[model samples]
Target: MSPTLTFALAGNPNSGKTTLFNSLTGARQHVGNYPGVTVEKREGRLRAAGRDLILVDLPGMYSLTAYCADERAARSFLVEEKPSCVIDVVDAGTLERGLYLTVQLLELGAPVVLALNMMDEVRRRGLSLDTGLLARLLGLPVVATVARLGQGTDDLVRQALEYAKARRGQWKPLELSYGPDVDRALGVMAARIEADRFLTDRFPARWLALKYLEADEDVIVLARGRGPTAAFLEETAARLARHIRETQATYPEAVISDYRYGFIAALLRRGVLQRTASPDRLAVSDTVDRVLTHAVAGPLIMLAVLFCMFQLTFLTSRYPMDWLEAGFGWLGEAAGAALPEGLLKSLVVSGVIAGVGGVLGFVPLICVMFFLLSCLEDLGYTARMAYMLDRVFRAFGLHGASVMPFIISGGIPGGCAVPGVMAARTLRSPKERLATILSAPFMACGAKIPVYLLLIAAFFPEHPGMVMFGITVASWAAALCVAKLWRATVIAGHSTPFLMELPPYRLPTLRGLLIHTGERAWQYIKKAGTIVLAISVVMWAAMTFPGLPPDRLADYDAERAALAAEREALPDDGSAQADRQALGERLDDLDNRQTEEALRRSLAGRLGVALESLSRLAGFDWRVNIALIGGLAAKEVVVSTLGTAYDLGQAEPEAPQALSGRLAADPRFTPAVALALIAFTILYAPCFVTVAVMARETNWKWAAFAVVANTALGFAVAVAVFQIARIW
Candidate 1:
């Protein structure tokens, strides 16, 4: 009966930190947003050595300087939560660069246990790491581990626990010399900070002084609010900065960084690391990158890889999609038959079944795409994608970092725009970040996938993959084009130079793929069941009430009775079977007209009809207009709305057809219309959630601009496509 101890897992991106976390926590983990922030937080629990342990997987960051949301969240958690221990995971192969963050963590005075991950890669490269020597030099415990293979994880955990227990929550900051002048400034600043007890309850005095030297904005803002002591520290920092700039032609931050590296280098030179291989030799990743990242062939390979991804997803997910579609269809039919014909029956069958089912039916396809994308991510190819696209991104007036936001927004087809908008925070430049935030919604995110797939199935069934590939490419083209326009116009500024670290490639484990895919798919399903279901019910009510005038109902009933009497009279004689069928057809037409008229008079239907004059230019009918309007809430709602619209408009409420089939059978829905709709969907305003996030991230002004500008652009594109295609 021991209390639970918390451990924070920290490391650079692709340092196998996530792998170690996955191995440690397995199915015991849950993901959520950090309080008041969009950055994802993952926590897992485990029972180890008769003690319950909680591991928090912090966002991957290079330092605690809070450059982006990820760094800020990680740093805030460490300072505020004060986890029992911070496990600093480092890449063994890139020990020098990895240790930079480790140095910062140590200086912050957190209890640290170094997990030297990717040890297998290090050993394979003929590099030998002297763990005991390194541990002795740093005065901390170090454990070598290959996290992917689950090697040495147990020992790493054991050491981390023992280290935490020994420290007993005590923080002993590591002091390093930053040359002569800088060290003097640090001494002065640290004394003032300790004397005033400024931010010492949260941050150590020396660490606070170091952050002030680095001009860390978060700390500086806090320091400024602490009276005259803040002014003294700022003046001291100003003096040191002036001295450094005058003598070294650089800033205090640069000097501090150089000295930290110098400290690491001095340690490594002490026989702590040995290399047996030739320095000129290229590793496997570098060798592969020569071609995969080649200027001439890289883009071609990337396109081919993306094309193949779409093809594989469509091909593999077909059967499961069919099964799901059939399952939902059967359920709808059963509900229709079991319930008496009434408002309740219509609501259940059309609103709940058709709307939510339309979205859920595409779950298999979404899952497959997510699985493939996860594989590429885990294989370290996604970074190379961003790296290769940097040139293209810069040409379009965006930072290379913008490529990731685009991808996360759905550049790969399964991304969500909320995170994509949040990801734009990583861009340092305000203009570039705003432009990226506005343009990212143009990517083909997961919510839009169902709509695209439905149209592709209904119109371009011959080449679903190629059509989807074209749609994806078109989205990217539109995003970049819009970004260029924004840069030249509204949010104009120079693009910052892009620097990114590419992790070495590795084979993705099946468990990893499944976990990633499962998390995404579950989110999609949950939204469908919750938000989609609620919207569907509201839309159904909008399309269902007021029950057509009594006169209108009577007219339809009289027509039905006349047709039935004629059919009864003619069908008594076998020779008159053809005549009886003609009457029956007439009766069916009457019923369809009655239902269509009722739909046209309903509130949502009236609104749709009102817009048809303008929407028709883009090949959209009233029904399509209704669906498009619903799409503002969520892209997936387009499909569900279409399903509900078609269901409500049907002559027989007892039978329901798959949405794609319904669209394909409708004469108004041609290939041109489908293409136009796809274009509009891609370029239109992002979902409500994304818009809210954008508003929060930037401001209501820019968020409003995104909505108006994107919708206008989408409408223009759709109109042009429809007009040109119709003429052809």
Candidate 2:
């Protein structure tokens, strides 16, 4: 292999670094967890200019200050791994702010290339930057890019590689003056660091001196452990910090930060940037946000936007859903004809086909939902959703950051609880974080969407959009309510302020949207093929064995034979043919009865029957109980399990109704029962994966509590719905 160039892509959050990374790597990338942390590590390789280039997308951060996890991870990787080059993706529209981090990167003595992303946004805002002058002043290569549109990306990469090759181990750190007091201290610290070569192998001496002055915790800890020489440096830094605090009435870290921005401002003033005369002029984004974020209008518009999206999803997915149902039905019929009446046929039709097909049948709906969600996310409406819901969340004892976790967990309908629960890491308040994690499962995640759709189509078919809307609203309401209960009782803490920068909205590119949607849909399908498929087979076996006793089989056989004899005994006239048809129908009915009896005698069936005494309070029959039990493994398995249970037990083993249709036509199921099932599925214990994640994120105690508590709450709600509906 040719020598590979390792480059780290670094930038502030929402600076389009991710867009650039995706455009460069495409499918040749994988994400892993950072060692000993939940933070992600994204690495990809590209072949460019007759060489392989390794790209590492660092966590987005505003500065190299190691305060938060992202900052720590980003800084650690840059200082230790020492990539060949650092591509600092800067938002051209926010040039001054972007350069703040750029200055810090330069101080580390790394070869740097400025990927000035969102250049189109800059031009649209009537702002111009002299890239040549900027690059000359900063002593680095600069490339203007519109990452979303794939404009200038190749050049950006090429320039980055060229700079990396040229600078190869020939780089020197840059030092910016932070006034007289700090600079004098930095000079003294630098000399001491250079003399001992103290921690200089990893960080530039000047950067180490700066980090000490800033009182960075990680750096301070390292310095403390670096023998007495580094300890002496730490003492020197402490004295300087105290002196600066006394004389300037501010900490050295604050002073240093001020100068960094000051340097950026001075650089920008040097004929490098020009803008409209009115520096504070509002752009199109401002115009849109005026209404979209309006206190009163914003929430209403948000609701309308979400409701319409769900409505659109339902409308568009209906045809494909029907086609899938018909296709699965045909496959079942073909299987019945291809195989003899035996356990193999039963396994194929009931266990594999019915189970997997049920989950796949919802693929169209999921695709539409994911595509629309990706569009909204790309257009920047998701941030607005958090912004608008912050205050409302606070009323339920959640911080504003909880909103994103909730939305990611499926507040948007197609989200997964695993990521949603994982997203709780952003919340600073431990109490609030726990509450968000526990409640996020209540959201209408994509897994639960199929279950909801199945029941809604069966019972509330005339108003699916409205029914879906209600389910979504109910999910949010339930989550918030549960959060309130948790905060008020078990986890109690004051809420933290939610502050986030809202990125300016851009028209979503078709390619970007499709790529995003495809990724999400593929994940859903993968889960079906892997987890759901395996669970379906296991549940099928559980429901299939402990076959009907010999006596019961003999009884069914005798009845079937007598019915056949009766049919054959009919006269050879037209009336006799009609009588014979009636006898055959009775025989088919008897066969179906035998199947149901056999299923009831099986292991899973017996378990469901045992639970029916308790489950009936929630209007669930033994069959629904079995499916709900399967849902404990994965919400998607609920539909699949129901398909298997119904297909195996119902009259038609060869040609069966759709799962929804089967439930609808079954006399034991009522609208009240369907509504109750929906409620329970919506509020029940999260899937096994989510519970495991919850344990990892929090603790096993809380994870156990979530299962017991959530299940109880769901059962209560389901019983209440059933009881109230029956009363009416």
Candidate 3:
């Protein structure tokens, strides 16, 4: 009958905090968004020592400065929610850098239990950490852990629970001395804060004073509304900042940082940590980085890795993809046979089955690609990719941080643009961030993957892998080029310097990879069954209604009857087989003409026809135009829409053909047209959700620009490709 205690999990990027959380919670966790924010939140439940516990995984942050959204979210949660205890996970091998955030958490007055992760890495590097002595020096319990293998997790949890129960939601702030002048200023600020009871219910007095000294924007804004006491604190902070700038040629924030690090150094010097070998010794990561990060070889190796990823994705997924296609085909055929010929039958077989089925057939390929990309990420090579590409990014007027947004937006061919656009918040430079947001959608995301796979299979089946690699390369090329143009024109600004910490390479765990891959693949499947299905049904209605006039249909019916009667009369004898075959071909031709005429008169077909004049410049006919229009809603809809359009037009409905096969056999579709369509799909506007996210992240004006500009660019590129390929 005890209440569930809440524990906040906090750590730096790549500190193995996530691994530890996964280890502790296993499959008992769920992910959601923080209140009123797009940043993701993870929460899990557990029972230990017969006490129910809730673990909240805060976003990975370097410090609680609240400069970026991630930091702000973490800081706000700690300040407002008042979690029972914070488990600060730190990289034991790099204790100095890792403990920076720990110090901030301590200053914030949160009850913290230090989980020193990566101890195995420390031992491998011939480093020694004295846990008991360190704990004593910091006056906090420290548990050494190897999170990936689930080592020390139980003990860490026990220590956290024991510490949380003892603290009982009470926070004791750690006050560090910032020399004489600043110490005097802090004394003035802290006393005024405590006396006036200024925001102390949520934050500790000294901690608020420290944030004021740091000029934390979130805190300052809150302080502004607290009346006269707020003015007094602001004046004191401003005076101290002016004095520090005059004397030290720096600001209070810098001084405060130095003192904090100085305090940590003093603590570590008391025999808390030691190195068995020289500090300059090259570790495994550095040794490997010599080759992996080499200027000349790195880019080449990255391309080879990407090529292999695509090759493996296509090769390994072929059998499963084939099986899915066959299953869907049979289902569609069965539905067609069971239902009478009418709107309901078409809706079930062509609209729902064919449309959604086309997208679901590529699920195995998406899963394989996602799994491989997750492997690269967990192994820490993705960071190196960003590091290596930083130079190229800068040349194109993008910050090094932009590489991640691009990667997440489908730079690897399976990422979603919504999160990718949100990821642009990490960029400090506004111009670079906006450019990244606009250009990221150029990557071949999972939605676009089906479109690519369909076209590549239809026209370039001999080397689908190589063709896919080419498409990926082309996507990157387009993004970089557009970014450069933006930088040189409307969004012109000086590119900020890029600084990133490359985590040491580690073997990815199978469990972690599977979980990550499964989550992403499930999302794709769910979208196919939900969004794609609904849109497909709507498209089917649009393509089916206002049927060819009753008289027109009667003419086709009479021709079909006459042909059938002739076939019935002649098919009895083996010598008359040729005559019967000619009659059947004539009936099929009449049916196809009727079907095409009906489609041309339908609503969606009319809109497509209206756009065909311009679309044909890029080698797209009315049918392709309809699919492309549907792509505005979602890139995957392009595939599903095509499936529906082709199914409705197919003369031989008894034997349903795969979309790829149908496209390949269509007279209007050729290698040149397929290439143009692929190019267009890659460069067109992102899905509706991505556009909404972009609008939320920036504004509707920019989001509108992304749509208009990208579509225009896509069309222009498609036209050039189609024209040039035709000549060739």
TM-score of 2: 0.92
Using TM-score as the measure, the top candidate is 3
lDDT per residue (tens digit) for residues 590-643 in model 3: 988888889888999999999999999999999999999999999999999999
What are the Cα lDDT values of the candidates?
0.91, 0.89, 0.91
> Clash number for every model?
0, 0, 0
Give the lowest summed-lDDT range of ten residues in model 3.
648-657
Candidate 1 local accuracy as lDDT? 0.91
Worst 10 residues of 1 by lDDT: 650-659
Model 2, residue 17: distance off in Å is 1.1
Q: 38 in model 3: Cα distance from truth in Å?
A: 3.2
279: Cα error in model 1, Å: 5.5
- lDDT (tens digit, per residue) of candidate 1 on 555-664: 89988888888777664768998887888888878888988899989999999999999999999999999999999999999999999899989878534457899899
Candidates arranged by lDDT, highest first = 1, 3, 2
Residue 273, candidate 2: C-alpha displacement in angstroms: 1.7
